[model samples]
Target: MSQPQAAVGAAVPRVDARLRVTGRAKYAADNSPDGVVHAVIVDSSVGRGRVTGIDTRAAEGQTGVLKVISHLNAPELPPVEGGFPPGEPLRPFQDDRVRFFGQPVAVVLATTLEVAQHAASLVEVAYDAEPVSTDISVADPADEPETYARGDADGALDSAPVRLDLTYRMARNHHNPIEPAGIVARWDGDRLTVWEKTQDVQGTVATLSGEFGIPPDRVRVISPFVGGGFGSAARAWVHSVIAALAAREVKRPVKLVLTRRQLYFGVGYRPAYEYDLRLGASRQGRLTASAHDIRTENSRYERHSEGVLQPGRMLYSTPNVRQAYRHVPLDVSTPWFMRGPGYSTASYAIESAMDELAHELSLDPLKLRLRNEPADDESSGRPFSTRRLRECYLAGAREFGWHRRNPKPRSTRDGDWLIGMGMAAGVYDTERSEAHASVRLDADGTALVQSSASDMGPGTATSMTQVASDALGLTMRQVTFRLGDSLMPPAPGHHGSRTMASVGSAVQDGCDKLREQAISLAVRDEDSPLYGADAADIVVRGGRLYVKDEPTRGETYQRLLARNNRSHLEAIGSYAGASESEKFSFYAYAATFAEVAVDARLGLVRVRRMVGVYDAARIINPRLADSQAIGAMTGGIGQALLEHTVTDHRDGRIVNANLADYLVPTHADMPDMKAIYIEGEDYEADPIGVKGLGEIVIVGVAPAIANAVFNATGRRIRELPITPEALL
Candidate 1:
């Protein structure tokens, strides 16, 4: 008999690929509850102000208009509980104050979307406008900045033989997913149900329950599909709350979908940053000390913070390091995590500075990095669970043809284009959180597994099915996995790249337990074949239980259950997550290499190719991993050369609110891209031996492209989106 193939390491197609291609998949906006009415928000014209008057008589008189609700007539909601970032969260239609541009001031509900939209426009709102501070450079920073220090950075910089001081400016970026944010909400008496475009369904439920002054069990959020959520959908924004409120007031289901224009301010964005870096290294390119001062934009109401200081403290072996991160309040909506979040922003500065030092020392950029590889995490003083960054560098360099590149800028020219090669290292935390999964094996020789985790375009369902198939020793076709319902066993939110490490592990545990239960029953049964055999020696494959050394002595699960008059086996698997006092530092590592061509006359920078080697431990699905890597690389290319969110400081309005004006990389802009994963396992990081992959792929991409531009032009552009004017 042929041995059954394991599904875990195989390149399996996504289980939902057919559903997506056939248009059977249902996203948040696709849900249409019975008797659903449409709602359109009337946004504020002023950036900062208080609403003095609202004339809704014209909107209320419109045909099919059910009601026009604003802060003037809206009921008071319960105070929000446990707001994030240690400040007040924006509540829609709850107050008269307009905190930022496009703040929702009124909601128009009608029988159809067109009527609601038209009515929303008819509503007139008068604001007492106030001066706005939207530019980070002109705004004052927080009174106290978050500070960290390991040694005397000032003393080291003063004594070092070589030093470089650089300042970088990064424009704000929006998520701009293919599908805009939407919600379908219904209130059945005291219980509420909602279908929302969110990365965390349970988190949305909690937020709604708190605001409505209802019990947790009274709220249910269902979101089976997400078009694409970089990080904007991780939390329940105020729009979701507004939808629910409208449903209750109108006594019918309400559907609210943000238009393309509304998405600019309706959802969160990646805030702009001004990073100032000073590094001191030896003449031979060995690091001595570094200091980083970072200021990023935030809203005056909510103080947003992230892991911006982590990379500066631990990415290298620098002994003396000082870091200060401050938030500059602006008249805008709060910013949230976008792609790699803080690590990507910091890497651009740190890695670019490293490349500059390499050039100053007349050394290979790759070699200079190799010289400062850390044995342990310098920030936490903990050994690494698996730091294969050196291997990544060596493998990436070999694959990307690093040895053939000339050191001097502008030396290699391809006719009108100046060709150059550059590389940078990337890292992100191997974050894990408590999770649970429920598994049930039926007598029909099939299994079902479930969790509350979300997919968010990483193929979570497919990967979890693969893990379950391997753990249960069943064929991939016989196992089914389901997610995105609050009723399923609890799991962590599908952000931070923790879905695989946390939810996948729980699925494996659940499947293993069910398989073991069946084995125990078969061994103890007198009527079963191989009775009294050692349970330890028993293994299940292709839904058949057999002795490991004697494959012929086996029985099908279907027959065994039939003979024993059994129905099914079930188990709930759980993982308690990482310990706070763990001894090892856990992170996913990558070495990204890029090749670019610069048109000096037009000041254009075009990427020719990119290669990324990652050490993310075990990969459940290579196909899915490659998709993540390539997509992130594309986004990075946009960040390096095109994408930017322009703000009008005059009134705190986003200048380029639509895609036509705000640029992203097109198909023509993308070039050859490759992703290679190192073969290994990191058991210390999680039970599945898998570190996170999604965020790390994008961490160092911007820096790699930026470094390549410098190599081609011999001009250091410290700002992001190395624009044509900047290159010229």
Candidate 2:
């Protein structure tokens, strides 16, 4: 808590904000390797089929057409592999069998992007088509769902004085980042180097090495900057491999980017959900029992399901609970993680149901939630490293003017709009994994810190640099922090908001060790100031070592190193020992508040304002954290009101594959937004004690807006993107 420490609970500006604002940052697509040739993929026209043959004569004959690589002439790759046993591995053009619609069948490399695109249309494909199952409702359900029970729910629900049963459905959504998913690959002899848009560079390298039967070291992956991932780039997809294959076949570097339409199938998305909830409560609105039945879509070749029921299992202190979660298998592309994935979906149902209970019991929603707040994690019975959900509500309500709520449907009206306010609680796990960093001190006294962590528009590089500077007693300008190449020290993948807790710890460790080395050298030198001071009593400031109680008596690191005739000092700091299992029970909590205006005639709903109060522990950079929290809240608005993926089902294909057809929120759609950060520490989680804020910022957003809609117009609509037709 000291002023000069630069420790936890301070709002610091991001060190790299200027680079991004000045347009100096570089993303994956920005890398233009010399001799790079553009490549375009050709996808299957049918939904499902067996490719009888491929005719590439016309495409191969075009000018600047290096070659058309398909199953016929494509070099053999190791069979696709999956870490999860039940899921199918994505095999790009490995055989004649086509699993789903728009699966890539071939790649055409050309001198220009337009030329390759034109050539891709010329290639001909013939297939024996088969009927496909795209709709989960029409498909047969799994015989038995994964069931977890604590107490009898049927009897409790029947006997309780208050009860509610409801179902919520959500549509598939795409991760449409500003920069399209693409890759640039170059082949040097048998080794391949790729500049790709990905969340996990190491995961990409390992997968590519396995696919090509090459050593992992031979494959290098770089993704320094990302436009916005939203979990789409969590793992390597087929497009990266397609580019590498094209480069190998053409004997030239290839730059392949998925077309907007191709992205629908090239990557994965959040699977659709249908959730049924049954709840029982006491007359005083203290909860009793709950039962949940949920089903999500997956591919016949793979089993995919989110931990969607997790929030319900622990968020509230319900007594008797029974839950059944099942995945309905269909012939469709497997789903991957999305922003707030499981937490967002589950919160919408549970929180909305809580709102309805409050109304039925004639009690305020905030009071109802406070009544059921658990002292510890109910599911695990572990004391929380920190639980601020109640604090988030109390503080948020005061800041958001919760007392001013009209508390009556359609009671507060402004001309043609019905105005109302609502709020909901949010939660997400504070995940951690093994990470490592290397710190090097040069003769000139400048320090270099390297890690494999990436900045996906979240200012990761900037925050990590701040960590190194503070720990090593160096000014921000003297420490250079580098990230994004697999060659750097290891780091956890940027997901689940774990980057800071995992990678920041690594940085702190590396810098602390490096600082210790400097101190040791300074103490041993007879020419250094305070030569006989105890090592533990020496503190560093501005790259200088001094006795703890005095400021004037100090020796610069450069002076000590030069007097000792040493060139440079180095150390490897690893926080890989920090894992989720041992450290602590960590999670970030948020309270989302929303105010909306509804049109009685048009059924148009416009969110007028939103406030998100978060308890994410120590914030490294207030400026960047504010932007992230607001951006996530804006994105959550889209999830609650505007975004939804459409499917053609007839041919088992996504209908709105492009951005234009698949609507996302633009600047005009955003409302007045505010983000509040709570200052605290949980040293048990990591050295930095910083819990994740990225995912939790949007966790409870949808439910808040949905509850607001009900308040504005006495209507309880459970499904997502609560459309005009439903209210009208």
Candidate 3:
């Protein structure tokens, strides 16, 4: 028997790589609409104030200047609506109130970008300044802390034999993709077309339509390529709206691209966090209770928060657990979801506490986690769809040589540097939102599939093509998958690692239906070679429909379609979402191990190598999956040792707004990194059996490095970025 030709699990290259490398793939800023003019924004100088008056006389006098738009002259827009819940949206130029520093107060339109930029700088504004508080520590809580409790946490903590209380702080981080946030908006009569850099094309359409009071069908968003998002490009910001408004007023296309400095305020960033964790465990390393008090910073207007406490509630088996998440509204711009969101931040505190407990109990860190592994989700009391965290630990430990490590801090030395190894477990919820895909099989034996999903560096198009190619029994070259257009089938934005499980399933569903249509045609036709074959027994392979038991009785798709007079067969595939059966907990798990060399005298920490083993169910394109894991691990390294967004608390200004000051991992910083995936599939999680991989890879990375630093040096640092000053 011949096995089916499979592309789903193959290590296929990205379909769009050629276009990207050749600079042919059009980004948002690359598009040049007819009669396109340039637009540049003027930001407010004061952090918190109300604009008294605006003087645009100098800007208007500049040659090639089209218009200077500000609160004094810009038209009123409909009230902004629809975003992640809990906060009022910020509307552009709606009034004179300046909520934060660098708030967009005006825009300049001109014939060229330089002219617009020069004109924007000339616009002067007057403001009535007010006292501003950007410091997270000084800001009062915006609302009552949200609390969750399961058992008697205080009582359990008091009775526990071993206890540890630790406080950890993480600095704010920004998403600085090489391509800055940009938009090219064009208006034709009442219809609007925008080429935007966004993670969600449909979300942009809905947001723009609501803001403009236009019907949804009249707004079109095209974003086939996104340089990088890391969650910053997930929403439609005020710049996109400003571009559209300017285009409508000027009766021409308007292009606006945020500079590197402007990106700090133009888009949202990951909020800084102060996490206080109190843990209780038995003498034998059994977890008894856990309490987490988390305070995160956000804008004064919007209350932004992510899934921060989920790791505390579900990552381990604790009978008594309590959590309180408080949003401290500061005089700053709104914060948004970043890579790993809440789980990454929480993992640092929870996982570090676990490491401390291991040191206190004299048990191996991995063994301690293994001992407390729950049979089901302790929070929900539901069985897991597929939990292979134990497998990840075993594999990662074996690959990283964890058994050779000395648990005693500062014990192992390599001449001037102290050597240490540490490991931490990671978890991300399996999120599957509703998505739809359209697949069409042409009579010429080629197939096309499309979704409205965005590819923010995770190879969404490549992965979906692999799925469709396998499902439709077509070769890799015969299938092409397209995404990032609002006119295509609707898809949830690519975030929380949900694109593969949601959009991939829809592609599979749509391709399966199309294949069935061809099978029906081949079986029913009397002139076809497959006429006598049963439809159920017929299988399609290499564009040929043949009986499974008898391969010789077959006919080609082109021949079959020609005889049937069919030009093409199309179907719309849809995945409603995960079932509501309430029987299973679905999550992607990883075990991250790091080896670091710390110069105790000089306060220098260098990560020598790192290993990440993931049980992210059903590998689709192993090459792409590996790239995703490695990229995430690199970001994790940055979070642990390099990246920090320094803000000037006095004036609510980001001091390191540019890449030169705001550090990220360069080639010299990346160590010998390895990514490994345990081979398996979780069919219960979704149709394609893919547990998401993007977010899980970054979850435990920071803690692993932090724990390794502790192992290398006798001192333990709870704060993030593990600065040299702290080591000294």
Off by over 4 Å in 1: 1-5
| Global lDDT of model 3 | 0.91
- In order of lDDT, best first, we have 1, 3, 2
- The Cα error of candidate 2 at residue 233, in Å, is 0.8
- How far is 356's C-alpha from truth in model 1 (Å)? 0.6
Error of 2 at 245 (Å): 1.8
The residue-by-residue lDDT of candidate 1 on 1-728, one tens digit each, is 12244998888999999999899999987888889999999999989989999999999999999998899889899887576667998987888999999999999999999999999999999989999999999889989999999999999999999999989889899898998999999999999999889899788888999889999899988988898989989999989999999999999999999988888898898889999999999998889999999999999999888898999988899999999999998899999999999999999999999999999999999999999999999999999999999999999999999999899998889998988889999999999999999999899999999998898899999999999998888888999999998988988889999999999989978887888888899989998886999998888899999998998998998988899888988999988888989999999999999999999799898999999999999999999999999999999998889889988888888889999999999999998999999999999888789999999999999999999988888888999878999988
Per-residue lDDT tens digits of candidate 3, residues 1-728?
A: 12265887888889999999999999999999779999999998889989998999999999999999888888989775556646778888889999999999999999999999998888889999888888887778757888889999999999999999889999888888888999999998999999999999999998899889999999999999999999989999989999999999899999999999999997998889999999999999999999999999988888877989888988899999999999898889999889999999999999999999999999999999999999989888889888999999999999999999999999999999999898999999999999999999888999999999999999998999888887888888999898999999999988989999999999989988888888888777889988867778888888888899888989888898888888999999999987777589999999999999999688889999999999999999889988989999899989999888887877778899998999999999889999999988998888888999999999999999999999999789988888889998
Model 1 local distance difference test score? 0.92
Find the number of clashing residue pairs for candidate 3: 0
* Best of the candidates, lDDT: 1
* C-alpha local distance difference test of each model: 0.92, 0.84, 0.91
TM-score against native, each model = 0.99, 0.97, 0.99
What lDDT would candidate 2 get against the real structure?
0.84
Report the number of clashing residue pairs per model. 0, 0, 0
Output the better candidate (2/3) by TM-score.
Answer: 3
